[model samples]
Target: MVSDPVQQPHVPVLLRPILANVAPVTGTWIDGTFGAGGYTRGLLDAGATRVVGIDQDPLAIEMAQPWAGQYGDRLTIVQDNFANLDTVAGENCPEGVDGIVLDLGVSSMQLDLAERGFSFLRDGPLDMRMSQSGPSAADLVNTLEEGPLADILYLYGEERASRRIARAIARERAVEPITTTLRLAKIIEGCLPRAKPGQSHPATRSFQALRIAVNDEYGALAEGLMAAERALKPGGILAVVSFHSIEDRMVKRFFQLRAGGTGNANRYAPQLEEESPAFTQKTRKGIGPDDEELEINPRSRSARLRIGYRTDAPADDIDRAALGMPGAGDRKGRKG
Candidate 1:
C-alpha cells in the first residue's frame, strides 16, 4: 500500500538570488516545483497577482491545496511533471505568464520520508517514481539487462563503478530479486572498495542513479525547460534552481545556447551559425547559496541558481539535442 512521506521543512536555496532575478512584479508566474509552496508564497508576497504551482506528486498538491483559500484566486495548483509545463501552463494560464521558477531535484520532503525510497540513509521500498506511474526502480533493478542497467547508471547517475554495480545487482537479483532500499544499498556497498579518508557512502551514486532512471528526471527537466520557453512571454524572467552537477550543467548550457553561444568550433575558422541568442542571462554565473543559507539549510549547499530572460528568438534550431531529453519533441505531453 502507498503512504505519504513525512513532510520535512523545506527551506528553498538561493532565495535571494531567485528573488533578485525574478523581481515578481505585478503579474502571473509559475512555481514549477512548488514543494511546500515556499517559492509560491515568496512570489505572492513579492507582489505577483497570480502564481501557478505545479508538481507531479499528489501529496504535494494536497499539502498546497489549503493555501488556495488564503491566497484566493491568485494561486493555481496543478498535479503534473514540470516537464509537461507547456500543456499544463497553457491550459491553466492561457494568457501567457510573466515569470517561471524551476526548483529542480528531489524535494527534502521526499528524502525525509524513509518509505519514499529516495534516501540511502533510510530503509524503504525501491520505488523512486515522482509521478507514481511508470516502471519503478525496483522493476528496473530486478528485470533490466546488465548492459542496459550499467548504461543507465553511467549516463544518469554518472556512477564510475557502474559496471561493477550492475554486475553485483544482477548477481544478487538471481539469488532473489532485490527489493527495499536497504537491500539494494547493502549490495552496492558490498561491491565498492573500503573508503579512504572522508569518503561518502558507496550506495550514494547507485541510489541517485536509480532514482533518476526510475523517474527519467533528466528527460523531464529538458522537456520542462523547453515548455517554459514556449509558455513564457518575451522579456519574462526564467529562473532555475538545480541541485546536482548534471542538472546544473544542463541549465548552464541551455542558458548559454539561448544567450547565443556557438554550437561547435575549430581552432581558427570556426563554423559559426549566424543566429541571435534567445536569452540574456541575468546572472553571469550560477548563484549558490550563501553562508547564512547553508548554515540554516544544509541541503542548500549543492544548489545553484541560474536566471535568464525570454527572448523573441525562434524555438526551432535552439538545439533541443543539448538538453539530452526524450519524448520532448512530442508537443502533446502526458496529462497531469
Candidate 2:
C-alpha cells in the first residue's frame, strides 16, 4: 500500500462511492488490503454475506482477532498478500466473489506507531516492511549502492534530489550504520530544501519510495489487479482506492485496457490495439472524495477510486510496464 500523506483516521477513502456503486451489497467479497478493517466493516454493515479480509500484515490480523468473533463466519481473516487473492476467493466462495475492494491506503495504526518507521514525523527504527519480514529500510539504506539507492528514491519516491540524498546516506552510513528513522530523515532533509508552509516534509517522498521498495508494493498491486480480474464472477465489481499519482495512473490504465479502451499515457503517441474488454468501467474517470467526505477526513485528499465490472472474457497477463510500475521489473535494487 502506498501510504497517504497523512495518517488515516480509520475512515476508508471514497467508501461512499463504493457502497453506492454496489448498493445493497450481497454475497461474498474480499477486502484485499484489510488495514484497519474499515472497508470490511463497511461491507459487512452494508449487507455483504461474507467479507474475506486479506492482509499480509500480522499485526492487522492480530488486532482484528478481538472483535472479529462478533461477525463469526461472516468475516474470514486471512494473513496473506492480495496478489494471491484468487486462491483465497476460490476457497471462501467456490462460485466467485460479488465484489472486491483494494483500498491501497496504509493504516493509521502503522503510521501512529513510530516503531513501524512509516512516518518521518516521529523518530523510530528505520524499518518499513509491512509484513515485518525480509530486508528492511535500514538494510537498503546502509547496504545498497549509491546509484541503486538514488534510483529507488528517484523512480519509486519520485524525488528529484535522489542522488544528493543517496550521497548523504552513503557518507553518513560510512561513519555509522543509519539504524533509526529520524537519522535517515535528517540525511534526506539535508539534501533537499526545508518544507515551506503548506508543502510536505522534505523526507516524505524518500520515505515513501523506500517503503515501496522494501515491500515490493507496485509489483503486488499489478499482480493483485489481475488476480481480482480472475477471481471476480461475470458482473462482479472491483473497486480500488489509490493514494498517489503512480498508483492512480496504474488503476486508471488497468481499467482502460481491460475495458477495451486506450491505456496509453501519451495521447499523441500511437495507441496500442484494444483488448477483449474483460471488464466494463463504472465511470470513465476516477472518483475523488466529495466535499462532505473531505471535510470529515482531510487525509483522503489524495485518494482516488476507480471501479470496474468483470465480464465473461478470460483474464490475461498484462505487461507491468503497461501499468506504469516503477522499475518496470527492471530495477537493479529489486527484481519482480
Candidate 3:
C-alpha cells in the first residue's frame, strides 16, 4: 500500500510552460527528479500513456506510492539517480522515451523536513544526502580541507567570502565538530556581517555550497543532461527547470552546444569543426513563472525552464571544460 503524506504538498514549478512548450504529450516520459510526484502526475494527466518516475531519494520514491498506485502500471518508480536514466529507460521502455523532465536542486519536500537538514532555518542533523546515504554535509564540514571547502563555496555557491568562511570553519571545528545545521549556520553567520532588511541570511551561500558538494549536484547534472541526450528518441523533448543562476547557465550552455549555437570563444582562436546538431532549441530563452505562479508559490521566483528537441543525429560526448563545469582548479591553489 502507498503511504501518502497529505500534510506535505508540493506544487511542481513551471508546470504550465513545460506543458505548453511540449504540447501533445504522448508516449512514455521520465520525470528525472520526481519530487512529490508533481511532474509525473502532471505528465500523466496531460495525456502521457506512461510516465517513469526516477529519484535518488528513497523517501521520494516511497512517498509517491500512495497516488502512484492509482496510475498503476502507467507510473514506474525507480530508486536511482537520473544520471543513469538512459539505462533505466532502456530497460523499461525499450523503444526509448518521448520526453524527459528534470527539476534540479533540493526538493520542497526535503527542505521542509527538519530531520532532512536541507534548511538552515530549522536545526537538524547536518546530513543533506539526497540518497539518504554516503558522505553527508557534516562529513564534508568536519573533515574537508579549508582549500577544497573554500573552492566549493566560491565555485558552487558563488560565495564571495569563501576563504574567510573556510578559515572560520577550520577554527570552529578545532574547538568542536560541526554536527548540526544550526551550529554550521552559526559559524557561517559569524564570518559575515549581519543581514540587512530583505537580504538573505549570512549562511545562505555557505549552506548552498555544502549541499552542492555533499550531493555532487553539478557532476550529476552534467552527466544527467548527457544521459538525457542518449535516452531521448528522435523528436523527443528534454526540459530542465533550474532554481539558481549556476544551474540555469549550465542548461543554457548544454542546449547551445547541442544545437550548434555556440561558436569560438575567441575570434583569434581557429574555428573548430562543428558536430551535427543533436538538439533543436525548443525555447529560445529560459521561461520564468508568471505572476500568477509567483502569487501561488513564491518559491518559483528563482525557477527558470529551458527545453530542446532531439534531432536524428547520434548523441556525442560534451567537453566538460566547455560547459563551464566547476573544477579542482576553481580552488585557489591550482593554476588555470
Residue 264 lDDT, candidate 1, scale 0-100: 40
Cα lDDT, model 2, residue 289: 93
TM-score order, best first, reads: 3, 2, 1
List pairs with backbone clashes in candidate 1: none
State how far residue 232 of model 1 sits from its true place (Å). 0.9
**Per-residue accuracy of model 3 over 139-244 as CA lDDT, tens digit each:** 9988999888888888998888888998999999999999999999998888888999989999888888889998999989999999999999999999999999
Per-candidate TM-score against the hidden true structure: 0.89, 0.92, 0.94
lDDT of 1: 0.79
Per-residue CA lDDT of candidate 1, range 1-336, in tens?
446556556677787778876664668899999877889998898899899999998767876666667998889899888888878877988778889999988888778777777888888888888777788889999999987887777666667777888898999999998879999998888878876787878887788878888887887887788888888888888899998888888888777767887664223333447567778875669898888898999878889889989889876433445543322122232111
Cα TM-score of candidate 3: 0.94
Candidate 2 lDDT over 1-336, as tens digits, reads 323334435777888889998887999999999988999999999999999999999888887877899998899999999999999988887757999999884677888778888889888889998999999999999999998898898888788787788989999999999999999998888887778999999999999999989999889999999999999999899999999999998898888888997746543335577768999975788899999999998888999989998999989877777776765233444322
Off by over 4 Å in 2: 1-9, 263-273, 328-336
Clash pairs detected, candidate 3: none
Error of 2 at 328 (Å): 7.1
Considering lDDT, which of the candidate structures 1 and 3 is the better prediction for this target?
A: 3
